[model samples]
Each structure stands twice: as structure tokens, then as C-alpha cells.
Target: MKLSFNIALRFLNSSKGQTFLIALGIAIGVSVQIFIGSLIQGLQIDLVDTTIGSQPQITITSTSDDKLIGDYESRLSDISSDYEGVKHVSPSADGPALVTSDEENYSILVRGLSFEAAEGIYKTKERLVEGSLPENKNEVLIGTTLKDESGIQIGDEVDVLTSSGENQALTVTGIFDFQVANLNSSWVLTTLETAQSMFSYDDRITGIEMQVEDVFLADTISSDIQADLPEDLLAENWKDQNASLLSGLNGQSVSSYMIQVFVMISVLLGIASVLAITVVQKSRQIGILKAMGIRDSAASLIFVFQGLMLGIAGAILGILLGLGLAYVFTRFALNPDGTPVVPLYINPGFIALSAGFAIVVSTLAALIPARKSSKLNPIEVIRNA
Candidate 1:
């Protein structure tokens, strides 16, 4: 093994330029894999965070009438208590309402929520960008999108009129930036008492927002909730509500994997081409080594070592460059509201996987040339030379 290493090192050092080129090819492949993988993962995280932050993990509602779930809170509690993975549950009432400002009027989804019950469950209050959450029955919290569209500022009074012809004046206590493109456009939040009062529906709720301990268990828990619910009520998980987003994320992940596979194949081809050329250039030397009683296996091992070295060098460089690029992207990109667009997260598992992939490709690339070099006839080569 030591003799093989020494010979491989001698060969590599003698052809420094070629060795560097081989390493660069491997590095480019590794860089593409790392950078693209990280970017896609980052986007997935952003989508999940944005969607989940604005919507509950699971929701329980009425299949018959929107008021059924709210009116049956006690029965809902009984069913929710039977589930082990439920983190918290809060009742909500939502309906389409007209919100009018001095400058403009817009239609929005008015959601009625309990301040105390929804604090931890929905994280409704934490996203407040301006003013405070509604403290009285006549106060309201508007989404940033609504605030922008209507040009309503904090402390302004907005008239909320229900579809049932009930009208009430609400003080704009707060404006919240949920960072959801769609939700921001049409959501108006208010205290449950205020919403029920405006809609003239006492003790009624539209749905129940449920937070789960394990996000991956959402479907299971949602199924259990549905089974336990009254026939008139329905249960839906976040995955169902955001099906398109989840599907798009899954597609992106698969695409990223496919890209990495292609990149590895390209790198493998490059390494193979370089090694084949090296074999031809050193045919005389290989013949001499064989004549000196070096085993065929030993000769093959030398080329394998060279390929491995090239792959390692390239992969290391690629990882560094890819990480640097990811950092740059995360640091400078901004959303419409001038906040950071996406969060960058890199897992150790991904790094290990990428590096292992590069090494495997390098080893495979060296196989054919190494085998051919090992089979050279020493006497015939010397005579031909």
C-alpha cells in the first residue's frame, strides 16, 4: 500500500497541471450539487414557514354550516382531548365582510378569535406590525395587505359590515404582517366577541384551529379528529389546505436530486476522460512497472488513488464555494416588505451525502482505465516503443 501511494503521488506530482484540471472538474460538479441543493432546501423551508405561520396545522370546521363547529365547542373539546399529539386548540369564526376606510373599501375575510386562547395556538398576536391586538369587543386587527389596500392607518376607524346586513364600527387597533402573499391580501382579524356581535351570531364559531406537536403527524391526527367529529363537522390538515405548495416543494426536491445525479455523471465522465489520457501517456511506464514484477492489482490501485485524490480536492473546493454563494443569497435578498426573503439552513447530512457521492463517482470513473492499464503487456510495449 505504501509503495502504491508513493507511485501514485509521483505520477500526480509529475503531471500537476492535469491533476489540477481533474480536481477542478470534480469540484465544479460538487459545487453545483451543494449550491443547488441548499437553495432548494431553503426555498422549501420558506414556503413551509410562510404557509404554516399563517395557517394552523389542522382545522376543524362544519361540513354543513360554518356556525356548527363554534356552537359545539364542548363536543369539539371532548374529541380533541382524545388525541395525543394535539398541542393546542382555539376556536375561530370567519366570514366575508366589507371593510371601509376613508379612502377605499375592500372585501376581506374577517376572522373572529379569542385573544387569550389564540395567543399560543395561532401565534396571532406575535405578528402584529403596528398597534396592538383588539382589547375590547369593538376593536379589530387588520392584515398589512388590507391596511395597504384601504390606506387605513393605526387608530383609524373602519366599518365592518357582515353579509347578513349587520354593521359595526371597529377601531383599527393593530396591523399585522403575516408575510403570506395571499392571506395578507384579504384577511381581517378581530376578537371573537366583536365578530359574533357584528354578524349577529352569538356563541357561534366558524372553525377550530389546532396546533400539533409533530408536524409530520398532522395527517394522522387530522384523520382521528375527523373520525371523532360529528357528522356535520369536517377536519382538514395544513397539508390539505396547502396542497399545491407542498406539491411544488416536493417537485423542487425531486428536481434538485435529478440535477445532482446529472452533475455527478458529468463529473464522472470528465474524470474518466482524464484518466484514460493519463493511461495512454504512461503506457511505457506501466509496461516497465509490470516487467519489474508489480502485480496488476497494484498497478490498478495507483490510478484509483489518483482519481480519489482529484475527487477529494475538487469536492472540498466545491463545498466552500457553494456555501459562500448560499450565504450571499440569504444576506442580500429581500421580500416586498423589505425583510429577508428566505432563511438559509444547511444540514450536516446533506454535506456528507454530497461528498460521498463525489467520491463514488471518482472511483467509478477510474475503473475502466485502471483495468486496461493493469492488463498491458510489458514485452510487447517495450518492443513497440
Candidate 2:
């Protein structure tokens, strides 16, 4: 084995130009796989954070009616008591409404919440970019996007009309910049009492939002709540609410894997081509080794070792390059809303998988040439040389 490895090392050192080319090919392939994988993973994390940060991890709503607001507070309270993972539950009333200022009018979603109960979950007061959260029933907080479109500022008075035909003038106590495109553009926050009064639905709520102690257990807890709740109420996890987005992100991840596989195949083909050329070029050397009583298996091992060395070298270089590229991309890339994109985490599993893939491809690439070297007849090879 030592002899085989030494011979392999000698060949590699002797043919510096060829060894470098093959290693470079493998390095490029591995780097691309790593960089793309990181990109996909990063996007998936961002999508999940954006979705879950803005909305509840689980929502309990009425399935019988399209609108969420009604006299289900008693049922909600009951479910809240029964669920084990439920950390905090806040009942919300949501409906379409119009906000009008002297200069502009915009349609918006009005959500009513119990300020104290919601603070623990949504942290509404902390997220307020300007002014304070609503202190009285008449005050409201609006998203920054809503305020900008209406040309309104903190302390400005605006007329709001609910879908049920109730209208009231509200003082904007705060402007929140969530930095999320979907949330910022359409939501208006107000106290539960104020929302009920404006919508003329006192003692009713649209839905209940639950914060779970364990996010990973959300599916199980949501299922438990659904089974215990009335048939009319539906419990949904964050993934269920944003199925399309999650599915798309998953598809992107799968696509990244496919790209890595394709890269491996391409690199293997290049290695195979290089090995085949090396065999033809070293026919005389193989003839001399055979003449010196070297077995076919030993001769085969020599080339296999060479391929393994090239693969290992290339994979190491690729990992470094790929990680650097991913770092650069994450540092510079921006979301649609112009915020710095958070980096995608590169797990150890991915690195191991990439390395294993390179080794496998390298071994496979040497097989044909190894067989050719093993089959060379000393007499014919020496005469041809």
C-alpha cells in the first residue's frame, strides 16, 4: 500500500500541470455546490422568520364562517386552558377597513387585540418605531407603510370606517416599521375594545393567536387543540398558513441538491477523461512495473490513490472558496424591503456530504483507467514503447 501511494504521489508530483488542472476542476465544482446550498438554506430561514415573526405560530379561527369575529371567547378560553404548550393566547378581531386623511385614502386591515395579553406575544410596544402603543380605547397604532401612503404621522387624526359600516376618528399613537413587506403594507393595530366598538361587534373576536413554548411542537399542539375545539373552529400552524411559500422554499432546497449532484457528475467525468489520458501516456511505465513483478491489483491501486489525493485536495480548496463566497453574498444581498439579508447556516452534515460526494466521484472516475493499467501486457507495452 505504501509503494502504491508513493508511486501515486510521484506521478502527481511529476505531472504538476495535469494534477493542477484536475484538482482545479474538482475545486470549482465543489465550491459551486457549497455556495448554492448556503444560499438556499439562507432563503428558507429568512422566509420562515419573516412569516412567523409577523404572525402567530398557531392561530385558532372559525371554520364555519369566513370572518373570524364572533362569540367564541368562551370556547377559546376553554381550549387555552386545555393546551399544554400554549404560552400565551390573545384574542383578535380583524376586518377590512378604510383609512382616510385629507390628502389620501387607503384600504387597510384593522386588527383588535388585548394590549396586555398581546404584548407578551407580539411585543407591539417594543416594535413601535415612533410614539407609544395605544394607551386609551380611542388611540391606534399603524404600520409605517400605511402612514406613509396616507401622509400621516404620529398624533395625526384619521377617519377609519369598518366593513360593518361603523366609522370613527382615531388618533395614531404609534407608527411601527416591521421591515416586512406584507405586514407593513396592510395592517392597523388597535385595542380590542376600540376595534369592537368600531366594527359594532362587542363581546366578539375574529380569532385567537397562540404562542407555543416550543416552536417545533407547534404541529402537534395545533392538532391537539383542533381535536379538542368545536368543529367550527380550525387550528392552523404557521406552515399551513404559508404553504406555498414554504413549498417554494423546499423546492429551492431540493434544486440545490440536484445542482450539487450534477456538479459531482461533471467533475467525475473530467477526472475520468484525465485518468484515461494518463494511462495512455504512462503505458511504458506500467509495462516496466509489470516486468518488475507488480500485480494488476497493485498497479490499479496506484492510480486509485492518485485520484483520491486529487479529490481530497480539490474538496478542501472548494470548501474554503465556497464559504467565502457565501459570506460575501449574505453580507451584501438585500431583501425586497432593502434590509441586509441574514446568512444561511452551513451545517456539518452538508460539509460531510460534499466531501463524501467528491471522494465517491473520484473513485468512480479512476475505475476505467485502473482496469486498463491492470490489463496491460508487459511484452506488448514494452515493444510499443
Q: Which candidate achieves the best lDDT against the true structure?
A: 2
| TM-score of model 2 vs. true structure | 0.78
Candidate 1 lDDT, tens digit per residue, 194-276?
A: 77777766887887887888776899999987886778878899887777887898899999999999989989988888898
Root-mean-square deviation of every model: 3.6, 4.3
lDDT of model 1, residue 179: 74
Could you tell me every candidate's TM-score relative to the true structure? Answer: 0.82, 0.78
**Worst lDDT window (10 residues) for model 2?**
64-73
Q: What is each predicted model's overall lDDT from 0 to 1? A: 0.81, 0.83
